[model samples]
Target: MVKGIPVSFGVGIARAVCLSAKETQAVHVDSQPANVEQELKKLHDSIERSTAELNRLHEQVSQEIGAAEAAILDAHLAFLQDPAFAGEMKTQIQEQQLYAVQAVQQVMEHFAAIFESLDDSYMRERAADVRDVGKRMIKNINNPEGDAQEAYTEPFVLVAEDVTPSDTISLPRQLVRAIVAAKGGATSHAAILARSLGIPAVMGAGPELLTQTANGDLVIVDGTSGSIHINPDEETLARYQKQAERERAEMEQLEKLRDLPAQTTDGRRIELVANIGRPEETEAVLAKGAEGVGLFRSEFLFMDREQLPTEEEQFAAYRDAISGMAGKPVIIRTLDVGGDKHLPYLDMPKEENPFLGWRAIRISLDRIDLFKEQLRAILRASAFGKALIMFPMISHVEQIRRAKGLVEEVKQELRQEGIAFDEAIPLGIMIEIPAACLIADALAAEVDFFSIGTNDLVQYTLAVDRMNERLSDLYSYFHPAVLRLIQQVIDASHRNGIWTGMCGEMAADPLAAPLLLGMGLDEFSCNANSLPRVKEQIRRMSYESAQEVAKNALALSTPDEVKTYLASL
Candidate 1:
């Protein structure tokens, strides 16, 4: 009767059949000729194919916090390519005469031990990455021809202690109605992808779920509320089934709003856009009435999969985004990987201040190979549709200049190769850092648009880490300084005849909507589900009136006052 923290909500009862990573028999491969590289090659080939399949699933369906997924593939790629790591395994295989799968499993467990031994919470999280790859490798070897599946699709929910990228990929999207697991954080990979795909899921269910239910039992999953009900009585089941029908009916009604212009009750037009990660997310935008893609995170293309996505792969991804937008503007942000975001292949040392380290444009400018590859891909994809490039974490004028130079260099190469591209793609910068926010006027003059990323903006402005739940309350977007900086960037972008947008959580708030509208933000982007509610609020107030509301908002001393005054308007 031990209760565990419920990270996700939904009650599902399934039979107790836990699939754990298995160990292998010994093989003495060290005694074989040191040149038995063919065996290592075979292992690499299997992992590579598995990686390809995993990446394909990522492209087709959404999982939770998929950013961590790239970390999983990256760790596997690292393990596969690591001469020392693979060398030790092969040596053990020869010396001990072990089974191929078992030998590979043991070596992976060894690396998992290292990550588990780390003291830092962030680094310690890497243990999951190690185990994910390890299990995937064993799965590949054990059932080399196909996934070890007892079912394909049954419209049933999967309840597990945990779920992985491999597990999600192996499931048929149509058959699986929802997913519930007992472990994983809010930003866990399972949760993030579920949000992307619009699947109803709940994770971290713990023992109460496993101990209470059996497999093949009917259940209800309330993703919106994170609740699970098992074997509902006839009346209860009928009620929930009715609720589900109503929800579907309501969603069908919203579909009619897709192409219609977003106008407030007062007749003020508000731009409604989608926050997308890859080109795949563009379809949802078009389906949900998005005028365009407001935030196209390029990080998805750069990370996650084993191989560095080639220019063609990136170009295809970008091309798909542009074509899907159907002439609507796609504002693409160049790689924003840093701090909590990592590429295992990069070999970046553990840093004390990852937030301030080689990240975003800083890393791009320094790593010409990585940066140029991405820029070329975007430029090539630009020919397919309207495309704009935005640089992230631009704290200094010099950084922007350096990044621009690389873009120019890429343009030159395209010219040399006689490849066509949008020669006049609009360039933008994310004014996220305080230094960038304060100096927005200069940055605005140098770029075509400015997007205020309040997630990092609030964190950087307040000197508080948003991930630190202990100080989460202290992470305020309503701080006077933060508002001032937002205004500064907005004012600067407007002064330069460029439009401004805020893609952070602040952009979606009903209270802050009036303030941002007053500050002259030309566009607002947020979660697709939030678009209607925010648009509804905007339609209630005139553009001129929102300006007045924002003016009064600046004088407020507390977050509550800001909220009250805005609502009063």
Candidate 2:
């Protein structure tokens, strides 16, 4: 058995089929023609062909899996359409006199190397996308009329060194039962695509497993535990088969809990919501029985574009999410465009510590015109349904006051223009930075609600850089200090007559459900797929018992102690 990082959550048993990029021979590029314009035209044509193919794949994946998986193709499409990237290729053809294919290969290698060198795992996986696009372009150049689809007849688990977004979308779904990758993490595009497709995946399985197993070997993938058993014994196979059956049955049972209130056995009700990235994902969120949207990331509208999204464009997307929920609260977080998420036109400086640098509300405050446009859109969307505004990475009472001032300014402008809006829209701030947590009481008095963004809160509190693989051991949600801070945030918010919710990865964890419940969190927002399970966990535990668990956990000094105490519950 080999251990790796669990990306998608599921289990499968199947014969393994090894896939390696190295196995595919490099395409030969004919020498550059004397006519540079002809080579440039060839490059443009290849890009167009690759984009058309990607669009087809996007639709195919959306129909088969979900819109989120298909959205991965959107990023690819953006890269293909990026003028700067294409311009670089044109430069290589014009100045270096390289063939169109050779220029593509050279640019692909150059940019892929740069991406792979990044500290962030998500950013690093982008390198795979560069290669994927390059591969498509080369194929089109090599044989424009050739078939793009690669077929495999038999059903098996796919084992690859690295699974790209395009690779996942293009794979024969019926023939691939599971995916075991030697590289990637939960946040990688490959993993996101797998989860959207409901395919079990184990990422970062390391290089040894690739060497130990041969093609067609019997492989058992336990994605929930991030373990892969190669050529398991008969007894092991039987156990895994039973385990898979149990998992299937449990998922079916969990679906029955969808409509039920996320109430404790003691009759305390908890709000269960979803964190969505795009407006297109609202249907999936609703289908998962989310009562509302806890975090509607507005950055999606701003990303992957050459220019800023217009107020009308923003309104349409936000309106879809708000109206789709049918009066359920939608907490729209304003554009959070720094710290790993960059826009082409933003031209943000290269900060030494982006996470702590000018990001989130900082960017918004600095660019009031941009901030006002989004606020106007949110206010306009609020007229359709329950819409609330939430600021990310807020740290000071003054920042909240300043942001609220802008909200009022926009409201006045809309009122003067006789534009309809939700004048009573609730405003809130994300408790991410430690300074915000410590001063929660002061900040709480200024806002209507508090949503703990534990993903960042934990990292900041524990002084651990989660993107660093070596620091994985230290970057834990179970840390006592982090839990203590969470307790403080919840307690402070409640004291100020405001409810506190968590819209982070921690809220989705079933094991942490009791901890959060005991912390007295008013709302639990997680990924849509995790809603049923988290709600089920809440239903099984009594609020009083959860309180006791929290009380005991707070007394613990170490993460292991808190973890052990929680496990005993």
Candidate 3:
């Protein structure tokens, strides 16, 4: 059995179909091409062919899956049209006298290497996109007749070093029961596509996965637990088969509770919402029975592109999300860039400790013009539906004042321009920093609501890097210190007449649901996939019992104690 990170949840049992990485590797040509013009023409023709193919794929994905999933292809298309990308290949073909295919391979690999060197994980994943496009163009140039799509006569588990976004979309959904990759994270475009398509996936299983597993080998994929078993014993296989059936039964049961309120047996209600990055993701949020959107990660719009998204572009994206929610409150967190999310277009300096250094609200405050543009877009989108603006990583009261001041300025400008907007759109801040939680009352008074970003709050409080695999055990949201801070923030919000919502991974956890509910957390926001189960858990217990659970949990000395106690209940 091999362990990996679970990206999508489901159980898959099938024969392993290991996809070789050799095909995607760059092949250099030793001899220079005699005809430079002809080589350039081949490169240009390949780009055009790849572009047309991508267009067809975009339409097919939109019809079969969703517009949001299909939008990834648009980014690929942008790369094809990008001067830096194509022009760099042209330079290699002409000056270096490299063959068109060889130039595409070399240039794409060079760019992918640069992306992989970046500190940010999200930016590094983009290296796959660069390679994906290059592979498409290479295939186009070599086989103009078009390569035949791989057909599967039986369901199988796709084992690869890493599955690209295009490959993920192009796979026959019925035949590919699960995906087990040697590399990738949950946020990778391929993983996101898998989740949207409801396929089970376990990524980053390490190099051993490729070496040990062979085609036709029986594989059991427990995506929920990130476990992969190759050629399991009969007894083990039977147990997994039973577990899979049980999971299917539980899913059917959860579906019945979709329209039900996330209310305790004693009639205490909590708002269950979803965190979305793009407008099209609102479809999954609503489908999962989210009462509203708790956190709209607007930073995604800024990343994976050449330049900052214009005000009109930002406004259209925000507007579409608001419209999709259909009057349900949508909280849009403004531009939380820097620290793991780097924008190449933005000339940010290299930082020693990025998380502690220039990031989030600090960057926004320094670049007020950029801040104001995002504010204008959010406010403009508010005119269409219920839109609320939230600022991230605020530690001091001055940051809140400065950010709110900008919002007011944008509102005034919109008013003078005869634009319609929600004048009373609720403004809020993410209570992530330890300083923010300590003075939550002061911060709460300045905003309509507070959303506890536990992911950062835990890391900052424990002085642990959440991304460090070695320190993962130390970075627990269930730690007494983290819980105390969460309780403090919620208590302060109530004291200041503002409600507090939690938009973090902890919100989706069933173990934490009872404690959070008991703490009087007004809202619980998480990934769309986890919503139904969270709601179901809340509905089963009494408010009084949850309160008692919270009291006991707060008294616990360690994270393990808290988790153990919660599990017992």
TM-score of each: 0.71, 0.89, 0.83
Pick the TM-score winner.
2
Steric clashes per prediction: 35, 0, 0
Of 1 and 3, the candidate ranking higher by lDDT: 3
Model 2 C-alpha lDDT per residue in residues 390-468, reported as the tens digit of each score: 9999988889999999999999999999999998999999999999989999999999999999889888888877665
The lDDT for every candidate, in the order shown, is 0.71, 0.84, 0.86
Highest lDDT against the true fold, candidate:
3
Among all windows of ten consecutive residues in candidate 1, which has the lowest summed lDDT?
A: 7-16
Q: What is the lDDT of candidate 1?
A: 0.71
Model 3 residue 441 lDDT? 84
Clashes of 1: 35
Task: State the TM-score for model 2.
Answer: 0.89
Instruction: Give lDDT tens digits, candidate 1, residues 309-368.
Output: 888888898899999898998988988887777876777667877877878888888889
Order by TM-score, highest first = 2, 3, 1
Candidate 2 accuracy as lDDT: 0.84
Residue 81 miss distance in model 3 (angstroms) = 4.9
